[model samples]
Target: MKYTPHAYQRYAAQFILDHPAAAIFLDCGLGKTVITLTAIRELLHDSFAVRRVLIIAPLRVARDTWPSEIRKWDHLSDLTYAVAVGNTAKRLAALRQKAEITIINRENVDWLVKNNTFDFDMIIIDELSAFKSHRTRRFKALMKVRPMVSRIVGLTGTPSSNGLMDLWAEFRLLDMGKRLGRFLTHYRERYFLPDKRNAQMVFTYKPRPGAEEKIYEAIGDITISMKSGDYLELPKCLTNVVRVEMNERERRIYERLKKDMAAEIAGKEIDAMNAAALSGKLLQMAAGAVYDGEGQAVRLHDRKLDALEDLVESANGRPVLIAYWFRHDLERIRKRFPGARELRQEADIADWNAGKISIGLIHPASAGHGLNLQDGGSMLIWFSLTWSLELNQQTNARLWRQGQKHTVTIHYLVMKDSIDESVMAALSRKDKVQEALMAAVKAELGKE
Candidate 1:
């Protein structure tokens, strides 16, 4: 396909060409992959600045998305790439192959860094937020070899999905602590105040006055951010809340679980060991099932299932992508709609885009990033909710992205007066924080 670069897209590519260590906080559906790839093509061929490049991404993206993008674009056809995934033998074999770009999953970053010679000149982290934790093995491993790489790029839509604290680890890997600080403790001490702390430990932190702008200013020269609404003519997205209520008996069972942290539904004994376990159990019960003591899912009620059926039927043959959370939800959904297919493999993704699957099922975490399903359908149904703002936004972007033609409609089956309501509220609160962070560093591509 011929590539016609949008003005912002060109600016993003130029930003990468200019900075050795860069962070691009681009919104979903803004073609971050292609933009970064374009700059990489120039660096490899035009400038002859980078001989070898490494891209770290989620598992599926490493295996499929990057290679497919190289093949899809006419301008990127000259770029040679290989994917280093799977077991050690396969990964070693791919690493041996001479290619301009070598792609590997984030999970194996430690193994690659520890076992092999770190030789790539340029590195591109597809979802930089995945390395937001300084404690993770991948982040630690990448940091060990960070000084060796000459050029690096970090790309993400939800850079601060949780809060400004996430930017520390990310920028640490990018600029080697030049912007945020050398240590997480220093970053927190400088800009944040302890929040929700006991005498023993601090649970969370709130930024001090003027901290957000200070953080943004520190990273402004290296980072460029953009929102899709500000650049692209994306299709309208309509969200609907399909609320469901439980009957008296079901309500009593929910209340019993909430109070006692244990309840019996359909003769199965359900128990929650702690506050966290109780929250999971409550969400399961809200979704019409709960795991018993023996780990068996006990059916609570079919209110969500019935509501889903109505939405699927009303689609009237229009393909509907259903996002589920639990294994029990997938089993129940599959049993309810035998025709429902889970989008698991690359073949399944291709089939979905071909419009071969009418009713599709996907888990938000697995299908969250780097997979584009916009060509499949515009209607998405969240049969169950997730608490992560990153996963929620990424999953919704599957069908509501750039190439989508229709006014995408997202349906949420919220169980009233249940934990589902809390999840919805939490996602909204986190989104506001993320929006503020993005606005602080939003890119201004004035007059092209």
Candidate 2:
């Protein structure tokens, strides 16, 4: 329980010590929470400059992270912590009371700012990407309080998911128009492609050479970026694709549904315009959902179910983390892998980690952030793939993390020659695209 700083944590603590107004861009499972806490503690102890530390994070993380980290480190026992969730009056009272640290979800930040709540010495924005959208009320409120805050730290695994524009909002909060300038649209125009061919007219950016270096020089001293692969001695991740050909019965049902959908939109000439919707319906059917008579989902293909069974059987008593995309997928997985625990069920995750349960079903979106399931399992089997690279990476980190004892092996069950292959390709290039976008932003700022 004592504050046994890991090597990566030590690096983070040192970075924070050197630059108090810094952001830690550490990977999801790289112990950013503990590092931030340690840094806050050190800052408080070293100088009488900092008093109360405010942590802004997602609801689940806000409710769980502070207390959990405090309990994990014995050295942090003296630090008092309070969460703002229930009874606004009570939470406000608790905030007014002298507490070393207070954590609140980002959703409530606007309300707190509007009410003129307690001022904080150090403010930490966990999962900072949530505030990437500059037009949001939360971003506007946080911007107003930027000048008042003494030290601001932004933490995120995917800082530039949407693009370079995401950094403007976070940087504005951090340094207040000092770093990355004031307007995102202006910044985009200065660096990105002028002409976008799409109907939406979305601009794309190509990072000029040396752009990353310049950005690093601008905020490099303040921001510490660390990847999990660089720190954790994680297990070898082996991605195996299990392609399931649609059975003749399921194929026939899928074709019928497609034909009916086409007929329904025939007068309207629903061609490529409605292709996405039509394809989605077909995919749903392929995944085991049948339109039957009404719009209700009915089971059709047991191939996916059979694949899951084979995976669970091969687990060899080790806990298996199953990533399911659709609700129908969840139902099929639950039915096929009986006694398999779902991540949302509090008792189930606890039991699974305690070695009482054999398998855990996790939806990528739900199980994506702030939960540490690595202690329980090192195996992840993706029953399906989504277009999101962030979700895929986050889900994989559930097992391939710092605290994990074993090497994590990721098995991806991809349907061959289907949309699955294209989705995976898109997922693979997303990170690279994000990196390019960030570099472009850095270049634009460098020119300024």
Clashes of each: 0, 2
Query: Which candidate tops lDDT?
Result: 1
Every candidate's lDDT: 0.93, 0.72
| Model 2: per-residue Cα lDDT at residue 172 | 75
Give the Cα error of residue 161 in candidate 1, in Å.
1.1
Residue by residue across 1-448, what tens digits does model 1's lDDT show?
9999889999999999999999999988888999999999999999999999999999998998889889999999999998999999999999999699999999999999999988899999999999999999999999999988999999999898888899999999999999889999999999999999889799999999999889989999999889888887888999999999999999999999999998888787888999899999999999999878887888989999999999999999999999999999999999999999999998999999999999999999899998889999999999988888899999999988889999999999999999999999988888888888888787888634
List the candidate 2 regions with Cα displacement exceeding 4 Å. Answer: 87-90, 116-118, 194-196, 203-217, 247-286, 290-295, 298-300, 433-448
Clashes of 2: 2
Estimate, for each residue in 319-372, the C-alpha lDDT of model 2 and write its tens digit: 888888888788777777678778785576677778776788888877788878
lDDT value, residue 181 of candidate 1? 92
